[model samples]
Target: MSLAQWHNKRPPAATGLRLDFDDGGSEHVSTTTTSSALSLLSDQLATQFDRYKNEMARMFQDHVRIVDVVDRVDSLLAAGDGEAAPDCQREKEAEASNAARHGAELEERVARLRAEAAAWHPAVKPPCPSL
Candidate 1:
């Protein structure tokens, strides 16, 4: 999965991410924002957050801060992945497309009927004498 797909943004044509090193060196990333990259970043941040919590526990032994941080992170991740957004727009677009197709079919049928009617003419002879 493309991490960028989470936001539905069109990927840039040139996604070169440049990183500068501390020793006057630099590296360029031709590709980024893949699922693996996101997973790695998430793991690293979680580790750091765990360390922060441990340090706070050592200093003040606060359990409330841990709960608060977990709740905040859960909500943040949900928002980041668009879990709170509705999928109504896609449904509406699909309905509109089906309606357009049905309208086109109706138009074609009407045109065919009109053409047949234009070619139709009254019978030259009377009804059969089967009566």
Candidate 2:
């Protein structure tokens, strides 16, 4: 029978009568049977939704903790770099000082050699020959 005929049909006189219908292969439930089924379906859906929401909340908390750890690691690396900068500067300064000291020592040695050579020279030294 068509859906309109079924909808217009009067409720059975008996209190617990079961009415079977065939409405072109589609399900059609009467108000009498739907109340309990709908209630069970709503309860099941609510429980599943709550579980899904809780799982998503846990995953979000884990992501937040991971981000916090990454931020701390990055800050530590930055602090290490900051600390290394002064050590590098000190090393460069020490190298420069050593180079300057070595240059002064070499100059003094050359001056002393020149003085020694002058003292050992004869009263009159021979002039340089033509190339």
Candidate 3:
């Protein structure tokens, strides 16, 4: 969910009663008025939640990719003791290491973002008992 999806202003449907009044002295006079401001908070929040989940999944994918690379490298290193070229072995090891580090970094970022999102999410209340 991109932040762009959220509405910066309330929606027309979300509007509620807004009351106002005025008092006058001497002759004595009074006035009142009301208005409502709609909102799209719920929809925005849902989008944000979905985005968070998507990003987390992407992070998990990164980790899986790294693991796969490492496994492949291990296989190549073991399959042929002499067949594996020095440059090929070095490149595979480096690529595997880089992928692993990137995966870890992505995971860490996802965790922190999720934590932050959780903090901002509304508190859930217990269900009300039936009358």
Candidate 4:
């Protein structure tokens, strides 16, 4: 029932390990070895459980992040499709073409004006000098 009683109740009946010099002491090598091995196994199991839990947490986080990214991509695709309809694309292309044509016409006008100035001001040696 008590520590002293348990220790005192048993005689010097241990194996040859404790083996007192006067043959009065005792020891339990097998029992201690078995207990030590069990303790080590329990510690290893706890360590492995902790590692497994951390790995699972990381996996769940990554899964959540991937799901969020997928949701964003899906929404972007939905919005893109709605905004980039066929008519919208055609309109954008037409606008771009018109702008390019206008730019080219402006460039041609500038060139024509420069040539006219050069022909009208040959003796001046410089075109649009006042400008």
Candidate 5:
């Protein structure tokens, strides 16, 4: 029988899947069995879909974290580049000031040493060497 014929002939009380062929071949699957199988398949698909969603979310979060880290690093690098010249200039100024202070101190010590030397008189004069 054709599918339409089989559908028409189906008993009102029947609750099952029926497959009918043109040559009068027919197969009937119990509703309970089909429903259970379908339910199992649906459950499996739902579980796999959930897993896929979770994996995608984790990957997206990882990507965002990496992007954030890269952005922070770029900002720090930019800041460093901007500050480097001023840092160098400050260091140079400090070194110059220190050198000036050291030079003045040394000159003052030398002057003091000369004054001391000029005022000192030896208790005995050394013998002069004939040239």
Candidate 6:
């Protein structure tokens, strides 16, 4: 769904605290005091987390697929059937090459995502006096 629809669909009543920031800007930030608002915020965070997890999984899967394809090709080559050894080797090499490239791309995408996520929200521990 669109973000506008998501933002427009709020709960009937909010029971949580309201937080606002005014930096002398025209934009006004508002939050509700109900659990629903917190829940909504939590859900949004969860969605992002899930997306990250999915990306990671996809990267892993890509690597696994490459390995599986390569292994299949190797198996075919190892069969030693005098008839199609060369053809099998050629086809397997091509498949392996394609899978390797795809896997590399997936890894790069995952790395970029991880870097972006780290920049967005780095892990913190304990309370700091600066805050």
For each candidate, the alpha-carbon lDDT, in order, equals 0.72, 0.84, 0.72, 0.84, 0.82, 0.79
Q: Which residue runs of candidate 6 sit more than 4 Å off their true CA positions?
A: 1-81, 122-131
Candidate 4: where are CA atoms >4 Å away? 1-27, 87-131
lDDT of 6 by residue, 9-123 (tens): 7654444433223232312333233456789989999999999999999999999999999999988877867878779899999999999999999999999999998887756
Give, for candidate 3, the lowest lDDT window spanning 10 residues.
Answer: 29-38
Candidate No. with top TM-score: 4
In angstroms, the error of model 2 at 114 is: 60
Model 2: lDDT equals: 0.84
- Model 6: lDDT equals 0.79
lDDT for 112 (candidate 6): 100
Clashing pairs in 3: 1-51, 11-38, 11-39, 14-38, 14-39, 15-37, 15-38
Candidate 4 residue lDDT tens string, 4-109: 8888775655575555444432235556777899999999999999999999999999999999999999999898997679878899999999999999999999
Tens-place lDDT per residue, model 5, 5-61, is 988885544334353343332333355667889999999999999999999999999
Clashing pairs in 4: none
Worst lDDT run of 10 residues, candidate 4, spans: 18-27
After superposition, the stretches of candidate 5 with alpha carbons farther than 4 Å from their true spots are 1-17, 20-29, 83-131
lDDT of 6 at 54: 100
**Candidate 3 residue-wise lDDT, 8-68, digit = tens:** 6434452233222222331122212211111355667889999999999999999999999
lDDT of 3: 0.72
User: How many clashes in each structure?
Assistant: 0, 0, 7, 0, 1, 6
Q: Which residue window of length 10 is worst by lDDT in model 1?
A: 21-30
Residue 33 Cα positional deviation in candidate 1, in Å, after optimal superposition: 96
Q: Write the per-residue lDDT of candidate 1 for residues 1-131, one digit (tens) a residue.
A: 58777579644454354432332322323244365688899999999999999898776645677888999998897776664345666778899999999999999999999888777745345778995
